[model samples]
Target: MSTDTTLETPSETVSPILKSVNPATGEVIAEWPVHDADAVTAAVGRARVASAAWRELGFDGRKKALLRWVSYLVNHADELSELIRKENGKPLEDAYLELILAVEHTDWAAKHAKKHLSAKKVSPGMLLANFEAVIEERPVGVVGVIGPWNYPIYTPNGSIAYALAAGNAVVFKPSEFTTSIGNYYADAFAKANPELPSGIFSTVNGLGATGAALVASGVDKIAFTGSTATGKRIMAAAAERMTPLVLECGGKDAAIVADDADVNAAADGIAWSSFANSGQTCVGTERIYVVDELADQFVAAFKDKLKTVAPGSGDTATYGPMTMPSQVEVVRSHIADAIAKGGKAVVGGPESVRAPYIEPVVLIDVPEDSLAVTEETFGPTVTIKRVKNNDEAIALANASKYALASTVYSKSKGMEIARQLRVGMTSVNSVLGFAGVAALPFGGVGESGIGRIHGEQGLREFTRPHSIARQKFAIPGMELLSFSRKASTVKLIKQVIKLKHGRHT
Candidate 1:
């Protein structure tokens, strides 16, 4: 899941700095002073003051600035990818892919924000035709963004880039785990446009108090990517002022393999989806529901595919160590519970819980109500269950509190099954495919979170609409809007309404 524990108010320590380390080797990478509420307030004040000038740039101007930043990122992909490998503990190739996706989304937002947020002349209806009507989109001033560490750049860009494209200043607070990456990103924007004001895109470094201060600070909106528990805490704090929020929280995504599916193809797709990036992906598949007919064959194929995948710091490693040390225990507890409850491990077991890395563990016939199946296991482990048919598979999959995203595999019924799954997004034949297409709006319903962060909807999320109505010409002796209206005018209007809208047919 794309979750950051920035809302937890931990006890004070001797040092007022955060140290960034390589999760694989425990090597120190960098450090930054923890910004408290007062520092956070100053940063938000800068963003608020710069917002006016940023909004005055207009669509074309903001688009140019955003594109320049994107170009800078593309040129520095290798450097950034290397940092991600060391700091966040992902393979170099996967880190590069994350950068590529982030660039695609940033570019998409810059190019399309104008088309989506621009003023439009809407239909005023027949009776109101005499008065011209228009709807114009306006930026919601300064926005406060609390980013996630999982996909540091790509996840937060869902808010930062789009907000800037829609003409608003942003004050971002990146997760303490990936502070360097976040600062590099915001610095690139300033480097690209030296003439622009600084606070248009800024960073605040710290943990809970910093994020908490940003929420409490007077900003137009708050965009957060984090855990459901922390998301609830943010809601409680936001309730003080009734602040608007866009939260993308935890997910226990499930993949359904149907009777008509190609066993080999489905196995390959979910293996990567389930274990890639050490299975830390928020939209990654953690649960699998296979038809009884294909259950055994699908299980064997998926297990074999996962055998080649291992976690390490080498160039050939499929993935790296778990980024957060605490998550290793979460994976272990879930596996223990699944085994104690009569589940069979098809791949690896308790021995897989290495300190820095956990090898892939594939379980079969785990209870649906168990922690492994019901909760978001942000690790390299997955559970496979046998279902009678598609009906049973869909029901079990939709039963989770998270309706974030799901995958369906069926040669003939792919689209049909996808349409029925209750989720914000579903991939018919592939896994996590919706993320690459920048035009798709990505968010979930229920406990998964609120609002979206991509495409035209993502652009509009940072703005509000204003309605303007103008009167063109007045008809003689027809004062319908004023008390001076004549009785003849009322009678004629009644006759017209009777003919136009009187019949049900």
Candidate 2:
């Protein structure tokens, strides 16, 4: 049974508190004061004040400060990993890996921001040949980030680090379940760079109301990560203020295996991708389509690999318990619906979804429209279906309304098959390879969410371009801007246009 405790309500306690509980043992790991709408507004105001000074630091200065903070994170990685383990119920190794990824992203953002965001010179059009045009990316002032709990450090840092590097101050509101980790990250950054203005990396802790308040707090822009339904609500709220937003919502990602693929490697990748981090990953494999000839072989290999997988808090455990207790019920409901609708459970079944932990569950021949297949299960559960050929597998993979991430395993035509899937990012022979390469943009199309959060595009997301056109020198015979110019100038312009472009048209 899950021992998770409900957060204290105003009527139940003298003061409202956001408690971070250990999902494995249901122990209260930490508590933070619940910030209300007014408090969130104040934090954004402070960030607005701090943004001026932060922007003044320029790219090099900000990069130095950010690198200092990264050094602190790397130095104290062990302590941070343990904290992640206790609060998120993920294994220590996975927690450490998350930290390493976060640090790498922070480093990348600091080093690459200047190159990507600096002003660039461009040629003026023929009609404005006397003018010099330049485009500069300017910070969007204060940015609000409402982050997710799963992979708390790595996921939120995707926004926080890039925003900071792009010269914007951030007001981050982590998921209610992972508030401590958020606060710790902010605190560490502040300690590493005491000279930075306060509120440059501020945080607001609370539940759903707090996030809504952040959306309504008049921040220059918002970056949110959560469910598609919640993302819609956020869009509605931000619409009132006409604020720009980047919504990184849920994903029903798929993996396609071709008949020509290496069966053993594909099976190993599928099993790991399906169950890693207890399958709570946004880009994790939830649905798989395998070509008919290799379906049985792949399934056998995947099941054989799953037999050694275990869920616990110990060192040797493959994965820990579910980070959110409520998620267990959702996983169970999806599996139950699939089975009731004639899906066959090849490995674990509905009985596997105990509180706190959901063991790996593999279902074969699941109905395409079933909840487990159609929706974001977000657990250690996956559905496998066999298709007639590669074309049918590609069609099935693109059938999801959400197209966040995908994987295609084929020796001869990996990239060819990957190009056919309509997803934001696809790994040819591996899972989530796009995320590790900081140069690639990461986000999705359709219901998966909007905007991106990595690479040059990610840095530019927190900024707006400011174009400047200066009249360097006036042309001797072309006074196009002045009505005082004679009709002869217009005739000459028409003749030049005819000579250059008329023939092509």
Best by lDDT: 1
List, residue by residue over 174-224, the lDDT tens digit for candidate 2. Answer: 888888998999999999999788999999988877777788889999998
Candidate 1, superposed: residue stretches over 4 Å from native: 9-15
- Which window of ten consecutive residues has the lowest lDDT sum in model 1? 6-15
Q: Rate the local accuracy (lDDT) of all candidates.
A: 0.90, 0.89
Q: Which predicted model would earn the best TM-score? A: 1
lDDT of 1 by residue, 1-505 (tens): 6457647543333258889999999999998988877777889899988888899999999999999999999999999999988889999999999999999999999999889998999887877778889999999988999998889899999999999999999999998889999999999999999999889999998888888888998888999998888888888888888888899999999999998999999999999999999999999999999999999899889988987899999999999998888888999999999999999998999999998899999998798889999898899999999999999999999999998999999999999888888889999889988998999999988888999999999998999999999889887887688889899999998998999999867
Prediction 1 global C-alpha lDDT: 0.90
What value does the lDDT take at residue 10 in candidate 1?
A: 31
TM-score of each: 0.98, 0.97
